[model samples]
Target: MQDAKSTRITFLLFPGITQLDFTAPAQALSRMPGAELAGAAASLDPIATDSGFSILPTHDFASCPPADILCIPGGHGVADALGDDATIDFITQQAAGAQWVTSVCTGAFLLGRAGLLDGKRATTHWGYTHLLPLVGAEPTKARVVEDGKIVTCGGVTSGLDFALTLVARLKGDTVAQAIQLAIEYNPAPPFTSGHPDRAPAEVTLGLRTHVYDAAAARMAAALGATT
Candidate 1:
């Protein structure tokens, strides 16, 4: 039996999630001491990822306990989730009492749809930041932005940084440092063209044309339903 004082961490699992967004944070949080972890979905069936991967939920929505931290990860399927009342309701209820509400990538969009990010400083994938206003959130360009108990991370790989920061917040600096060392989380990229501002004109144009255009269209529809 778990102690009542143990921190309950819940990650929303849905079809078409960007697996790394959830996995990176979940893995980091699992390393925290006395944190009870669960992946909750509408059902116990396996959840599919945008990358053609699958993960099983530990608990269904009805069986999920209140969460200290509620994480919603983003992916191509967020459009569908935005329109899902059950998923939105679950998030709204859980976030009401959660010590921290969070999301990675476009997962922030779901949080926004739940009406949790209104007036909060939040972020999502770089391509989707422009849509933040649709959900009443102030778009932030940082990799991670935390406004009170609401923490949102930008893009996919940023989840690792966000999780490590959360560990330091929940546990302590030492524990977080140890986990970082254990995971060898250092990065040394050969290219410096990750963000739109820093990327070459052609690369940014390509992304805006192929990626941002589609994402914006989906977000526009999602926001319409939520509003």
Candidate 2:
């Protein structure tokens, strides 16, 4: 058996993945010096991100090695990806043996939908946080919540915070703090907050409506898939 320390890390990608949720954490994971990082998905082709970035999946699920750490990034495709048997089955199989399962933004929806978040505290992008419980999470508002083997983040941008938290946990606080210091990342926004509380009600409502529309559209398309 591979020692927990020796296990490799792989990030899972699905169509319509949120760019920051996938990239920021992948970057942070790579900061661990010798640790290996891979983007694994249903296909090794380029996957589309919600913010319009394109990421090439380096490993296809069929041939990818098991993960010690796994990341799931959410996007507009959650409804469809959640219903995808191949996508969800692969996640289920990989997550079963992985040391930790993590997600950013609405990606938690896919993880929650996969039965991974049942009775586990998890979160998604604030735009659709309520949906986490609709799927299965206890719905956390924290930028990052490490709930045993399950970790989740609140938004696309928070993915950076999630990665920072994960690194501190996985590699130790000094390493994590150094990274934070190196990045000059002591943040204090004039807005005084980071969630709906920080933003105006109108802004929050508009964002929520948009996310819901996307999720609903995907759900309509996923009606009969086996995921």
* Model 1: lowest-lDDT 10 consecutive positions: 1-10
TM-score of each: 0.95, 0.86
Candidate 2 is scored at a TM of: 0.86
Cα lDDT of model 1 by residue, 149-191, tens digit: 9999999889988988998887779888988888888888899
lDDT of 2 by residue, 1-227 (tens): 11245547788888877787788777766766456888888887888877767889889999988888888887777766877789888888889999889888877877776788888887776666655656556877677888898989887778888878877777778888877777777877788545778778887778768666566545534533433
lDDT of each: 0.90, 0.76
* Backbone collisions counted per model: 0, 2
TM-score result, candidate 1? 0.95
Over the full model, what C-alpha lDDT does candidate 1 score relative to the true structure? 0.90
Residue ranges of candidate 1 with Cα displaced over 4 Å:
1-5
